[model samples]
Target: MDLNQRITAFSNLSLFLKNFLSDATKCEATLNDFEHLKEELQQVIQTANRHNAWFTPEHITQALSSWSAALQKDNLTTWLDAYAITSSSEKRVAVIMAGNLPLVGFHDFLSVLITGHHLVAKLSSDDQLLMPFLARVLIIIEPGFDSKITFTKEKLPQFDAVIATGSNNTARYFEYYFKNKPSIIRKNRNAVAVLTGNETPQQLEALGDDIFGYFGMGCRSVAKLYVPQNYDFDTFFQAMFKQQDVINHHKYANNYDYNKAVYLMSLFPVLDNGFMVLKEDTNFSSPISVVFYERYTDVETLKAELQSKADQIQCIVADDFSDEDVAFGQAQNPKLYDYADGVDTVAFLLKL
Candidate 1:
């Protein structure tokens, strides 16, 4: 199909979902009862369980909501536009999905889906289930998508745009391999926050979601904190402790086990036990799912530090850092205006 055809198809798909999301029939438990629009999510999550054999039903359900909300056209446009670039002609793109967090592939999926191009997907072994599950859903959404997206286990296919996500380690290889193509080669990034004096217990409680959601594995999740000098750590910890049960979950425990061993081997200092580790440094990313806290005397100092690591961090959580920074705990849950990596997506896409 041509770009126009693909765009028309995607627009239709998007409209269908917008309508379906509000439909009463979409609440059915059985995939068989789900109509075409809902079938993509329904089938994809079911197949995800089959392929991974690790993701629980709860994980599937959570991811389903994540993608569903993300693809809502009004909310998605900002993020979607980030990948929009005018294609010379017929375009094909290869996308590598990240499995570090659940439904991490959704961005790459949206990149390809909105671009009106064929997606040659290389699924992550850690997160192999989501893409395939999504493939089933997309095919259900638009049957012709079977030909648009190709799933592979071995080598990748040729393409115009390459979207790859990996650690700081594999980034060099991605740059070398896809250097010639128009690509968004994302390296590891961490999220941080600027603390104010007015935060209440309720506000700190919300921060727990930014900290523990997805076990702090996602790039969007918070990894560091910048609180005012003399800020009461007691109040912060008090509010965040409401999620103690989250720390007790089995999946979170597994991360605790693996990261703790590495911490032991390296003898790294910790801030807390069995939950999050902390430290202070120039580095933005931290291990063991810990959030590093730094003391800042004023907003200017915090702004200066945030500017230094702009490209390495995701969202800045503070009272209101203007239209740019996201609200704390809202990192994983973005509003319609929130764009990925702070890039304006819709304008990017329209220009493309």
Candidate 2:
């Protein structure tokens, strides 16, 4: 398929997702060819939830909604407009996906196929169902994709290049294993919110979404906070009450109980709101159900500190702080062009 054909296929996939996001039973009239896939997709969501406790239906729906918004024809066209993309020599590009969130490695999948390369993906056991199901939907939309995608459980076949996402330790292994090949190896990174003590209640509530979405399992999920000196915790905790139901999940509740017990036993001071805890900490990565925070005396100094540790941070959430920072609730709602780890997947694929 040509570039326009690829773009149109994805756009149709987005519409299919929209139909699924809307009530599947009611959407059959609108989703003609996609109608049969709706029930199967629902089954996959159920299987995903059963296979991985972290993959809640609500979280999976949120992921689907994000992708639905991203794959619009205009969004695809505008994002691709930046690159001088044409057909390239088709090479097999392998992607090592992470199972942190539902459909987490989909962007890499889309990147390989959209750039006219063959895809050989090893699905993470925790998230094995969603991507391949979507690939089936894509193939139905444009049969050309059938020859271009492969999902395997065995040792990955020989490929020209690879893209892998994992923790720092696995990154070292990937770096060594794919040493001779052109690759993008991603490591763990956390997002942080910078609070100036001037945020309105609305903004703080939105920030709650950034912090608690997906049970804070995603790299883009805000895991830490930077607050001005002597910043009061009252408004922030109040704003977070909207997401209090996150504690109802047994896994999250267990983590909260365990972490809270550890902190109390250690005699460490923490601000608790029944559902989540905020601890004064300098670290970027925080435990589930806990948000680490550090106080900053000045913006310039804080900026310098974050810049020095740039590779350790995935996203900075703030308002009018820096052009690069994501807005309060938008960290998880990244556009098609918001390349993870600041590496352009399409550009890398194009080079291959």
Candidate 3:
């Protein structure tokens, strides 16, 4: 299929998702072709939490909503127009997806196929159902895509290029194994927020979305903070109370309990507000239910330090910290062009 065909198919997909998300049972007649798929998708969303507790219906809906907004024809066309995309000989691009969040690796999947390449995706066991289900919907929208996508359970088939997301250790293995192939090997990275004492309660509450979204499991989730010395915790904790319901999840509650107990057993000082813990640490990647924080004496000096450690940082959440800084609560809501780790997947795929 040509570029316009591809774009139209995906835009139709966006509408399908939006219709189901807005009201699953009352879809427009134009979506008659998607009627059965809509019912199936509802069941999938309903039971997703059973497959993976983190895939709560609310979070799954949030993911679908984000994609529905992102996959509009205008957004897809504008993003693709930035590059001189062409119908070159199709290359087999293998994608090893990470399942930290609902449809977390979809951007890569979209990058590969929208570039007119065949996709061989190894879905994470935790996210086995959603992507393939979406793929089926795409196939139904454009039968031309039927031969272009593959999901595997055993060994990955041969491919011209690869994009793999994983922990630091798995990244090392990917690097060595795919050394000869064109690849993007992603490692563990987390977001950090720079908080000034002057931030309004609204801003602090939005930051809670960055922290508690996805149960603090995604790479864009704020895992640490940089605050001024002697900053008071009273206001911060108060704003965070809005997200206290996150503790209702048994998995998250267990993590909070276990981590809190371990800190107490170790006799380490910790600030707790019932749901989340604030520990004074310099680490960027914090455990579930915990957020590490450090005091910064100067913004300029802190900027330099963070820049020096840029490889380990996925995003910086601040008002004006840097040109690439994601706004207060927008980390997980990246635009189509907001590539991961500052690496443009389309550009990389074009080169391949």
Pitting candidate 1 against candidate 3, the one with the higher lDDT is 3
Which regions of candidate 1 fall more than 4 Å away from where they truly are?
1-56, 76-88, 254-270, 278-282, 335-339, 342-352
Local distance difference test values of all predictions, in order? 0.66, 0.92, 0.92
- Residue 334 Cα positional deviation in candidate 1, in Å, after optimal superposition: 2.8
Question: What tens digits encode model 3's per-residue C-alpha lDDT throughout 1-352?
Answer: 9999999989988988888887756443255556687889989987777989989999999999999999999999999999999889999999999988999989998999999999999989999889999999889888999999999987999899999999999999999999999999999999999988988988898999999999989999999999999899899999999998999999999999999999999999999999999999988999999999999999999999999999999899998878888888898898998878889999999998
Could you tell me the lDDT of residue 139 within candidate 3?
90
Q: Model 2 residue 329 lDDT?
A: 87
Task: Report the C-alpha lDDT of model 2 over 53-143, residue by residue, as the tens digit.
Answer: 9999989999999999899999999999999998778999999999999999999998899999999999998999999999988888888
Model 1 agreement with the true structure over 1-352: per-residue lDDT tens digits: 5444444454444444444445547432223435664655556666666666446556656555655655554554544454435554435777787777666766656656555567788888877766675566557556777877887888887677777789878989999988888777778887887778688777788888888776677787888888777876767777777767766666666766777677668877655644655555446676645678777787876787678878898787777864577776687776545555666533433333
> What is the Å distance of residue 235 in model 3 from its true position?
0.6
Candidate 2: stretches off by over 4 Å? 24-32
Whichever of 1 and 3 has more TM-score, that candidate is 3
Instruction: Please provide TM-scores, in order, for all candidate models, with all chains considered together.
Output: 0.80, 0.97, 0.98
Tell me model 3's lDDT, rounded to 2 decimals. 0.92
* lDDT over C-alpha atoms for residue 176 of model 2: 100
lDDT of 2: 0.92
